[model samples]
Target: MNAKTETPAIPEGACITAKVPERGTALLGDVVVNPYKLAPLTAIIRDGGQAISAAHVRVLGRGERGVDIAYEVSERSLWTYGGIPVFGLYPDHVNQVEVTYKLDGERIRERYQVYAPAVRLPVVANQTAALPLVEPIKVAPGFEHRLYLFNHLLGEIPGGRAFKWNALGGAAEWDQVGNNWIADSNGDVRWYLDIEQIHDSGRRDGLGGTMGFQQTRDGKLIWGQGQTYSKYDLLGRRVWQRALPDKFADFSHEIRETPNGTYLLRVGTSDYRRPDNKRVRSIRDHIIEVNEAGDVLDFWDLNQILDPYRGELLETLGKAAIQLPEGVQKQESTAANELLEGDLPFGDTPGVGTGRNWAHVNAIDYDASDDSIIISARHQGVVKIGRNKEVKWILASPQGWPERLKAKVLTPVNAKGEALAEEGGLYAEGFDWSWTQHTAWLTGKGTLSVFDNGWGRNFSPTKLAGNYSRAVEYRIDEAKGTVEQLWEYGKERGDEWYSPVTSVVEYRADRDTQFIYSASVGFLTPEKLTTTVLNEVKYGTQDVQVELKVSSRQPGSVGYRALVIDLARAFS
Candidate 1:
């Protein structure tokens, strides 16, 4: 029997249709599904006769694990949606997706083949090039750390490998932590512990790419990759895995542990249909607090938090063919669906993965002192949200902003405490607002340390001439709503190097000198790929303490983020 004939037919008025990719399978049966841009397959369902309330969608990958999907009916009548997200499929492999729903006490089923494409590395002419002049300075003797790095898109790079780099010797070490580590692709958890001694079929081909990794003082290996947030002990044992709610997946970036034993997960939420007939698609950043039992305790919706300023945002940042959630539609401006992407409120563009890059919120850190959350929205700017759901302060350029919107931004100043010329009282003099920034955290000195990716600097009205990356420290005064750039470390080598995406700067205070760990440095283009690097610099002197340029086996490859941690503490 043919594949279609083998599948059972549904009753009248009940049909399932593909909503996302516009169709099932590739055009002309080419099987061309971009692995990196795998979209969730949403099947719109309309059941007749007795109203269908819930459905169980079971996904069995041809050569992968099984995923159980739960679909519930909303306020809408007789129609419910079921989806098997991209994360549930094995790349380069076909999956058997089965959907079962009941009507009039009878069970109905539907099945289809989900073809996932293989990883196709970007074409690069030069795989290896001569070393650039990376002048490295001396470190404060006896100070060393282990730099943990994960290749941004592992299989997409020719020879990209996620491993630890010994800061003292400046060499990549893969076996330091363990030859085996665990990773979650879709919902399948792969455990590769002791490759030589023991074997597991589900072991990933290589260590999967991670946006962030942390080893707590107690020795729990916490990591957030793809859409899953997981924790493991030093022995490579799984502790807990978060079963994130549907419609919200892809924890593509940062996750941190709060002081209260809760996990702060930076997740991507998309495809929120509003009531106004606008099929809204957005990769909105979300910070959800997950407790020890993998229960979401608290959540701060960034899109909703910033929705009130939609009018000013459109006017200031320029308009685009954008759609906001229903919550943000309370007040309206000359709102239309015709605007350039560069002029979008958050510098987002219609591109890979979701087709709408609303706000690339990469990193989020919790501040216990004030009970606020600091988020690095790469496409927009840095934001500090208070416990009371108020935007406490914002750090971004106010070039084309209206007077009312400008008042919401904190005025920037130079290192010498000199206010830059104020264009509507929101302009800065010495330095512009950080563009395409990342990895911001509250410092012990009551300042914000950020990895300023510097992607937006060149386009600023008051542009900082060279393309470069800087480890910046900013002092944000919430009461006065003012910001002071306390110190910044870049511009020594001009535009010799800059990371337009995925980088970090962590403050380290010791006896004699103050240092910052800067890692995941790379160059970014509008094409959305980077060439990575790592840097360690001293605080006051702005001297390069220790640096590791790209000596990757994969010449044109990059990593997402990096960190400097104690080698003993990390592997222990």
Candidate 2:
């Protein structure tokens, strides 16, 4: 027999008296504050009868520097039976929220004064005093209304004795240190994900927090931490969660959604055996394509695709390439008869070392136009591979590469279309290949944009005082096998803008600008500190329209990546 349809029950403790000002609309039944109890500065409005077609919420700012945060509830199902999720409420203040929703093709607007109690922000271990989370160093006029999501590590440095390799018995819990947060133009934290809801407590490995926090085109946030990958709507609602397949051990670096609805995840191989029958574990050198159902469709093992032993740059710079913050003690040789491991002074999560990190692939971007994958390997260079795992092109200095692989490296050319000498072409005038780079992706114009970390610049052993990182774009002529520099930033600022560890460069076609994130700017003078600077630069002129710096009192606080939240996407 067919089961009878049951009426959906109203949410528990929902305010039934909440109604539209004049319409007396009882269709919008209950209003519950923080329905999930996870996102503190949020609320939920249940639909009694009429389904809400759309919703827009705006939280008023307090002062001139405080920029108002607002977004439209993009997910329709969020307002169907569970409740309409409200976001961007100010903590410890009577936040003035302007809510507008459509019911039965009629628009209904209401004003809500939500007083969200202040919450205690997480403190890193060894910190004895309270410190400001993010500071607005510079706010440009036209870019006053923007939000940036910073993916960072908040606890004490990993790879230490207390939080070493598989030790989870550290003094600070993963939940206590927030690894992901969103801040407005005024440097006020508008929203943050309580890592407690996503961190895997049972895991013994130190890698438990989010790594790559990014918003999808549909206005949902997605990230990969350890072995789990999760996607959640802006309302702090988990849409779906998937785990890595058995072959993959841990997820790191990046997770990107393909146009075909599959996900490209950067993961570590469980136990890989070399051609010489040497069994060993590798990290951050594998990429797998998994569907929404958690099925591994295709895999790109960097060990197989690239020469794993190519370490000319790695050996020259050693641990200095990663620029580990000051005060972190370097590890000595262990008594146990184990393989010699390089020092990852800041933490192992940064994924820099000699063994098992040959091709530290920190970023991945797919090109549907030709079914190709572009990756940024810190030890190696920016590489593009085809569906069959064949190297399409290598964009790096032609040094120490095998004769066969060196043939695939692109030749550098000057602006006047003259080919520079291959021996020192990389450091030639107006052209230089990135060293220890981070995020490499194809821009809308089909050109490649990379966050050139500039570590080991020109393969130099000493850290030059003039060393600088830059957001560089290159126009590659595939048929000609040559590359030309298109535009760059941060090089003019010199060492002050050099971020050796993690950063990103994204092209914003909508605004004709580039979003450059300098994730780790270490200052060791008066005190050891790390600052993250974000800039939105104009396309051709290289004018910095927005410059915001995130300062942390905790030394060695490194930011992994930062992305601009496209608020307009929520309404679209």
| Winner by lDDT | 2
**CA lDDT scores, all candidates in order:** 0.48, 0.69
- Per-residue alpha-carbon lDDT of model 1 for 139-195, expressed as tens digits? 333332222333243223223333332211111211111122222212122122222
TM-score of 1: 0.58
Best-performing candidate as measured by TM-score: 2
Give per-residue lDDT, candidate 2, residue 532: 64
Lowest lDDT sum, 10 consecutive residues, model 2, at 1-10
The residue pairs that clash in candidate 2, if any, are: none
Give candidate 1 regions above 4 Å deviation.
Answer: 1-140, 144-151, 155-209, 275-281, 307-355, 399-405, 413-418, 423-429, 458-465, 510-532, 567-572
lDDT, residue 387, model 1: 82
Model 1 misses residue 65 by how many Å? 45
Error of 2 at 359 (Å): 0.8
Angstrom error of the Cα, residue 182, model 1: value is 16
* Segments of candidate 2 deviating more than 4 angstroms: 1-28, 48-54, 74-81, 102-107, 119-121, 125-133, 137-142, 155-178, 200-206, 318-355, 422-426, 462-464, 523-528
**Per-prediction count of colliding residue pairs?**
5, 0
The per-residue C-alpha lDDT of model 1 at residue 323 equals 45
lDDT of 2 by residue, 1-572 (tens): 11112111222122133345664444566777666555666777676655676666667777654566655565555543265566666667887766666666666667766777675445555554333367666666556667788887654433233333343221122322336667777777766666655553344332455777778878778888776788886557777877668887667779998889888988776566644444555667889998888888999987667765465677555453352234533322211112222343322333333224567788999989889999999888999999999998999888767655888899888877788765543456667899889999988897999999988788776464667899999998878888998888999888788887789999988678898888878743334467668888888667878788777666545678989887666444
